[model samples]
Target: MKSRHIKAQITSFCFILPALTVLALLLLYPVVTSVFYSFTSKHLIKADYEFVFFKNYIAVLTDPDFWTSFLTNIKWTITSLFFQIVVGFLAALAVDRIRKGKSFFRTILIIPWAFPSIVIALSWKWILNGVSGFLPNILVKMGIVDTVPQFLSSANLAFPVLVMINVWFGAPLIMVNVLSALQTVPRDQYEAAQVDGASPLQSFLHITLPHIRIVMGLLIVLRTIWIFNSFDMIYLITGGGPAGLTQTVPIYAYNVGWGLKMLGRSSAVTVLLLIFLLMVCMLYFRILNKWEKEA
Candidate 1:
C-alpha cells in the first residue's frame, strides 16, 4: 500500500514538473534577476558595473519626479475607478430592468472593452489632435475656441482626458460583471421589499447593494491594480508628454530603463512598484476579510 501511494505521488509530480519548470523559468527567473539588478549600477551597454546596495532606492525615493509619477498613478487609478464603477452600476441596473433590446444594448456598451486598447487610444488621439483633427475642428467651427485646443498636449487637461478615456474603456468590464452579479440576486428579495412598500431607492440600497457588495469589492480591487499598472493608454495618447504631467510609474520606469539606458535604476523602480502593489493587495484583502466577518 505504501509503495502504491509513493508511485501515485511520483506520477502526479511527473505530470506537473514540466509546467513548474516553465513557470520558474518565465516568471521566477526574471523576478529574481530584476531584484539582483536593482541592487547594482548596471547600464544597458556598459560592461562594468558596481553594487550600489540601497543607493538606487534612496535616489528613487528622493526624486520629485518619482513622487509626481506615483501621485499621477494614484489619481488616474482612483478617478477612473470611481467613474467606471458608478457608470457601470447604473448601466447594469438599467439593463437589468429593461426587457426589450437587451442584447443590443449590451453589445453596444461592451464595444469599447472589446476593441483593442491601442486602436482606441490612437482613435481618441486623432480626434483630440489640435492640428486638423475631427473633434477639434468641429469645436472650432462651433466657436468653442479660436483655435483647436490641444487636449492631449495641455498639462492641465491631459490627465483628466486620460482618465475619461480609461473610464470609457474600463466601464464595460464592470458593467458585465455587475450585470452577472445582478442576475444571480434572488428576485424574491426585491419582491418582498416591494410588498413592504419599499421605494425603488430603498429596495436597491437594502436588497441590491448588500447582494452585490462582495462582487463590487472584488471588482474594485482588481480594477484598481489594473489601472494603477496601466501604461499603454497613456503612452499611446500622450506619451507621458507635456513635461511629464501624465507619466505614471510604469512610464517612468520605461523612460529610465530604455530611453535613458539606466537599467539598474529602472529595475529598482520596478521593484518599488511591485512592493507598492503588494501592499495595496494586502490592504484590500484585509478590508475584504473584515467585511466578510461583519457580514
Candidate 2:
C-alpha cells in the first residue's frame, strides 16, 4: 500500500514537471541573470564581463536622469491609476444599475481592453500625430485651435496625453473586474438596507464598498506594478521625447542598456525597480490583510 502511494505521488510530480520547468526558464532565468549581471561590468556588445561589486548600482543611483525618470514614473503611475479606478468604478456602477442590454454594453465598453498593447500604442500614436492626425485635424477644422496640437511632442501636453491614453486603455479592465465584484455582493443586503430607512448612499457606503474593498485593493496592487513597469506604450507613442518629460525608469533603463551599451547599469536599474515595487506590494498586502480581518 505504501509503495502504491509513493508511486502515485511520483506520477503526479512527473505530470507537473514540464510546466514547472517551463515556468522556471521563462520567469526565473531572466531574473537570476539580471541579478547576476547587475554586480558585474556587463556590456551590451562585449562578450567579456567581470565583477564590479556595487559600481553599477552607485552609478545608476547618482545619475540625474535616473532620478528624473523615477519621478515621472511615479506621477504617471499615480495619475493613471487614480483615473482608471474612478472611471472604471463609476462605469461598473452604471452598468450594474441598468436592466436591459447589459451584455451588449459590457462588450462595447471592454473593446479597448481586448486589443494588444502594441495595437493600442500604435493606434493612439496615429490618432494624436501632430501634422495629419484625426484629432488634431478635427480640432483645427472646428476652430478649437489655430495650430495642430502637438500632443506627443509638446512637453506640457505629452505627459498628460499619455496619462489620458493609459486611463482609456486601463479603465475597461478595472470596470470588468469591479463589475464582477459588484455582482458577487448579496442582493439581500441591499434589500434589507432599503427596509431599514437607509438611503442608497448609506447602503453603498456601509455594505457595497466593504464587500468590494478587497477586490479593489488587489486590482490597485496589480495595476500599480503594471503601470510603474510599463514600457511599450510610452516607448511606441512618445519614445520619451520632448526634453524627456515623459521618460520613465523603463525607458531610462532601455537607453542605458541598448543605447549606451551599459547592460550592468541597466540591470541595476531594474533591480532597484524590483525592490521598490516589492516594498510597495508588501505595504499593500498588509493593508489588505487588515481589511480582510475587519471583513
Candidate 3:
C-alpha cells in the first residue's frame, strides 16, 4: 500500500512537471535576464560595458523627468482608487438590491469593462476634445462653462479627465467582484439584526460590511497595484503630453529606452518600478494579513 501511494505521488509530479518547466522558461528566465541587465549598460554603440553598479539607478533617481512622471503615477493611483472603490461599492449595492432588471442593468453597466481600454480612451478623446466634441458640447449646452472645455490640452484638465476615464472603465470590475461577494452573505444575519431593532444603516454597517470586509480589502490592494503599473489608458489618452504632466513610471521607462535610445537608464527604471511594485504589494499583504486576522 505504501509503495502504491509513493508511485501515485511520483506520477502526479511527472504530470505537473511540464507546466512547471514551461513557467520557468517563459516567466522566470525573462525576469532573471532583466534583473541581470539592470546592472550593466546595454547601450547601442561602443562595446557594451560591464556592471556600472548603481550609476544608472542614481541617474534615474536624480532625473527631473523621472520625478515628474513618478508624481503623475501617484496622482493617478490615489484618485482612481478612491473613486473607483466608492463607485464600485455603490454600483454593487444598487445592482444586488434591485428586484427589476438587475441582470439587464448589470450587463449594460459592465460594457465599459468589457471593451478594450484603447477603444475606450479613443472614444473618450473624441468626446472630451474642445472642438465639436460630445462632452464639451454638452457642458456648453448646460451653461457650466462659457465655451467648450479644453481638457486634452490643459495640464490641469488632462489629469482629472484621465482619472475620471479610468474610473469609468475600471470600476465595473470592482462592482462585479463586490456583487459576487454580496451573494454569499447569509440573509439570516440581516434578519437577526432587524429583529434586534437595528436600523437599516446599522444592519448594513455591522452585518453587511463585516461580512464583505475581506473582499473590499482585497480589492483595494488589487486596485492599488494595478493602477501603479497601468499604462494603456493614460498612454492612449494623453500620451503623457501637455508638458509631461501625465507621464508615469511606465511612460518614463518607455521614453528612457525607446525615446533616448539609452537601454541602461531605461532598464534601471524598469527594475526600480518592479521593485517599487513588489514593495507596495508586500506592504499591502502585511496590512491585509493583519486586517484578516482581526476580521
Best by lDDT: 2
TM-score of every prediction relative to native: 0.94, 0.97, 0.93
Give the number of the best model, judged by TM-score. 2
Our model 1 lands, by Cα RMSD against the true structure, at 1.6
lDDT of 1: 0.92
- Candidate 1 segments exceeding 4 Å error: 14-18
Where is the poorest 10-residue window by lDDT in model 1?
Answer: 124-133
Which stretch of 10 consecutive residues in model 2 shows the poorest summed lDDT?
A: 113-122
Error of 3 at 282 (Å): 1.7
lDDT, candidate 1, 112-228, per-residue tens: 997787898889988887897898899889998898888988878888988889989999999999999998789999899899999999989988888888888999999999999
TM-score: which is higher, 1 or 3?
1
Supply the TM-score for candidate 2.
0.97
Candidate 2 C-alpha lDDT tens digits along 77-126: 99999999999999999999999988999999999888888998889889
Measured with C-alpha atoms, the lDDT of residue 246 in candidate 2 is 92
RMSD values, in order shown: 1.6, 1.2, 2.0
Q: Mind giving the per-residue lDDT tens digits that candidate 3 earns over 1-295?
A: 9999999999999999999999999988987877777788877465666888888989999998898899889888999999998898899999998899999989999999887878988899888878979989998899999888898889778888888999998889999999999998899998998899999899889888888988888888888989988988878888888788889999888887777877777888988898988898898889889878897
Model 3: runs farther than 4 Å from truth?
A: 1-7, 44-49
TM-score winner, 2 or 3: 2
